[model samples]
Target: MNKVKENSVFFVSLLLTLIFIFWGVFFTENLTKVTNAVYNGSIDYLGWVYLGTTLFFVFFSIYLLFSRYGNIRLGRRNDKPDFSTASWLAMLFGAGMGVGIVYWSVAEPVTHFTTPPYGEGYTVEAANTAMKFTFFHWGLHPWAIYTVIGLALAFFQYNKRLPAAISSAFHPILGDKIHGPIGKTIDILSIFATVFGIATSLGLGAMQVTAGMHDIFDMPNTLFVQLLVILVATILFLISINTGLERGIKFLSNAAIICSVAIMLLVLMVGPALTVIKVFFNTTGLYLSDFLQMSLRFTPFGEGEQWIASWTLFYWAWWIAWAPFVGMFIARVSRGRTIKEFVIGVLIVPTLGTCLWMSVFGGTALDLVQGDHSLAKLITQDESLSIFIFFDHLPLSTLLSILGFAVVAIYYITVADTATFVLGMLSEGGTLNPSNKIKMTWGVIQSALAAVLLLAGGLDVLQTASIAAALPFAIIMLVMSYSLLTGLKNETVMQKGNKRNTQQN
Candidate 1:
C-alpha cells in the first residue's frame, strides 16, 4: 500500500494538471487566446535561448562520443545487446521521429520554399534555402538532444543501478535530494512534458491521416473526420500495446522501415532520380557548410523575427519537448551498448535516414514545382496534401498512396505504444515493466488530450503547449548533462582504483 501510494504521487499530480489545462482550454472562452499570448511572448523573448541550448546539446553529445568515457559500458561488462543491429536501428528511428517524418517530409520543404527566411518565394534560390533549412530542422541537432537525455538516463540507471527515471539522472547534482520534493517535481514535469509532446505529434498524425484519406477515398477533410481517425488509430495502438514491445513495436517498426524504403525507392525511380541525388548532396553540403550560421540564428535586428519564430525556434522547442519520451524509449532498448556506440547509433543513423527521406520526397516536390508554376500555388494553398499531390505526378500513384497511408498508420501505432510504455514506467516509479492497466490509462489519456487539442485550436494549440512544456524540461536537460559528466568522472576514478587493487593482489 505504501509503495502504491508513493507511485501514485506522479500519476495523480499529472492527471490533475492535465484536467486543469483541458478545462482551461475547452470550457473557458479566450483560454486559447491567453495560451497563444503566452506562447508568442516566450518565442519573442527567449528564442535565442532555445537555439543556443540546442547547439550546446549537439556539441556536448559529440564530446561524449570522443571522450575517454566513450568506452564505458551502459550495463555489466559482460552484457551483450538485447536486440540485433537492424532491429535496434529500426526501433530507434521509429520512436525518435514517428509520424512527423511522413507528415513533414514534403510539407515542410514546400512551406519553406514559399516563404524562405532570406529568399524570394518559389524561385530556385528559395528552393535551395528551403531544403537546406529543412535538413537543418530535422538533422543532427534534434538527435543530439535525444542523445544527451538517453545517455544520462541509461548511464545512471544501468551503470549505477539507479531507478529508471529522469530524476535519477540528477543524482550527481542533487544527491539524496533526488528522493525529496525536487526529485518528485522533476519526474512530474517529465510526465507532463512527455504526455503533451506525444499528444502534439498524435494530433499532427490525425490531421495528415485525414488529408490522406481525402486524397485517396474522396472523404471530406473535416474536424469530424479527423476525430474519427484519431479514435480508430487509438484503438489500433491500444491493441498493439497489449501485445508488448517485442511482438508489437519491434515488428511494426521493422515493417514501417521496409515500407518507407520501398516508397523512397519508387519515388527515386519515377521522379527526377538524378536530380534527387544531386539535390541531396548539394543540400547536405549547404547544411553542413552553414550549420553554425543556422544553429545560432535569431533576428535581434527584428527583420525576420516572425519567420524565425515560426520555423527555427518552434522546432527547437518541439524537439526539446519530445526529448523525454524519445530519450527514455531509446534508453529502454539500448542496454548493454557502450557510450560511444550508443551516441553514434542514436545520433547519426536516424539523421542520415531523415536526410535521405527528405531528399526523395522533398526533392521530388521541389522538382515538380520548379518545372510547373501551378504546383507551387497548390503547395502554398494546402501543405497537408503536398505528399499526395507530389505522388500524383509520379507513376503508380494509387499504389504509392496506399503504401504511404500504411506507413503513417504504423508510425501512429508505434508512437502511442512507445509513449504508453514510457509513461507507465515514469508513473510507476520507474519500474522496468509497468502494469498494463497503467499503460492503458495513459494511452487513453493521451488520445483524449490529442482530440481535445485538435478541437480547441488545431496545430496552433499543440505547438504552443509543446513550447510551454519544453522550457522547464530544457533546463532539466542542461542540469542532466552536468550530472552525467560528473558521474562518468567518478566511475573512471573508481574503475582505476579497482584495477590497481586487482593488479597488486
Candidate 2:
C-alpha cells in the first residue's frame, strides 16, 4: 500500500493497462471498431499534422547541429561518454528499429512494386519508386523524430539536473508545475504509448517468428504456437533484463548488428550485386531530389490519397507513437555527448545503413520479382513470408533462412528487453537502474498483453490505437522542441554572464 501510494504513476498506469488488455481480450470487436474509427478519423483529418511535424523535426535537428548550442554537452562539461561509439550506435539502432526493418526490408519494397504510392504498378518506374520511398520511410525523417525527444530529454534531465522523465522536458515551459498533475499526466500518456506500441510490436514479431518457423521447420502457425513463442520470448527477454543493460542489451545489440550485416552481405554476394549497386545510387539520387515533394506529399485532388493515408500517414503516426520509448532509450545511452555529435550520429549513420540494407534486400527482392510473377503474388498474400521466400531462390537457402530466423529472434529479445528497461525507468521515478522487481512486473505484463491480444485478435486494433495516440503526442513533441530551445538559449546567456564576470574579476 505504501509503495502503491508512493508510486502512483506505476500503479495507476498498471491498473489502466490491465483494463485495456481486458477490454482488448473480452471486447475485441468493440475495441476494434472504436480504434479503427479514431484511426481513420486521424488519418482523414489530421494526417497533415503528422507529416508537417515530422518534417519540422527533420529541420529542427539540422538547425541544432548548426546552431550556437551545438557544442553543449548533454552532461557536465567534463563528463565523457559511458559507452563507445560503436556500442552506442548498435544499442540505439537495435532498440529503435531492428526487427521491423528486417521484416519490411523485402516486404515493403515488394509491396510498393506491386502497389506503388503513385503511378502504375510493377513497371520499372514502380520499382524505382519503391526503393526511393523505402529510403524515405526508414531514413532521416524517423530518426529526426527520435532525435527531437532524445535530445530534449538528455539536455534537460542531465544538463539541467531535472528528473529523468518526459515531463522534465517541459521544465522550461511549466517550471515547477512539471512536478504536479501536468507532469503525472505526461508520464501516464507516455506509459500508455509505450505499453501499447511495444505490445503491438511483440505480437507482430511473434507472428513473423511463427511464419519463419513454419517456412523453415515445417511448424504449424497457430494461435497456440504464437502464444508459446511469446512465452519463450518473454522468458529470454526477462532474463536479459535481469542481467542488466551493460551486459545483456549491449551484447545482444552487438550480436544482432553483426548478424544483420552478415545476412546483407550474403544476399548481395549471391543476388544481383551490380544491379543493387546501381539501384542504390540511382534511387538515392531520386530520394534526395524528391525529398521535399514527398515530405508533404498528399493526394488532395488525385487518386493516391488512399495510398498516402495507408502507407505514409500510418508510418508517421507509428513513428511518433514509438518516440517516447525509443527516445528515452536513446537518451539514456547518450549522456556525455555534444548536441551536434548526437544529432549527426542519430540522424545520419543508421539511416545510411538502413538505406543500404533496403537496397540489398529490397533491391534484390524487387529484382527477383521481375522474373517470377508467382513469387510476387505469394509475397503479396503474406508479407511475413517475404524474407523466407526471397531466400528460397538463393544458394544455401536453408542456411539463409536459419540465419534470418536468428536475426529476427535476437531482435525480438533486444527490443523487448529495452522496452522493459525503459518502462521500469519511467515508472520508478525515472531511476536509471530500476529495481528488478519492477522490471519483472513490466516484463510479465507486456508478455500477457501480447498473448491476450494475439489470442483475441486485437493486435491490429491495438496498433491502430497506437497510431491514434500519436496525434496528441506529436503536439507534445512540438512543445518539447520549443522548451528545449528555450533552455538552450538560457544556458547560452548564463555561460556568457559567467565568462564576463571572470574577465572582470
Tens-digit per-residue lDDT, 1-505, candidate 2 = 8877669889889999999988988898999999999999999999999999999999999999999999999998899998999999999999889899989999999999999988888899999999999999999899999999999999988889887799999998999998888898899889989999999999999989999999899999888999999999999988898898999999999999999999999998998999999989999999999999999998877799998998889899999999999999999999999999999889989889999999999999999998887888888788778889889988888989998999999999899999999999889878888998998899999889988888787889999998999999999999999999999999999889988999999
Residue runs of model 1 more than 4 Å from their true location after superposition: 1-4
Tens digit of per-residue lDDT, candidate 1, span 1-505: 8876787656565666587566656664565676688778778787777987899999998999999999999988888988888998899899988788888888788888877898588888999999999999999999999999999999988999988888899999899888778888888888887887788788888888888899899999999999999899889888888888888889989988999999999888888899999989999999999999999886776688788888888889889988988999899888999999999899988889999999999999988888787887786677667788878878999988988988888888899999999998888888878888889988988888888877776456656766776876788888889999999999999999999999999
Cα-based TM-score, every candidate: 0.96, 0.99
The TM-score between candidate 1 and the true structure equals: 0.96
How many pairs of residues collide in each model?
A: 0, 0
RMSD of 1: 1.6
Go through the candidates in order and give the C-alpha RMSD of each one to the true structure.
1.6, 1.0
Which window of 10 residues has the lowest lDDT sum in candidate 2? 377-386
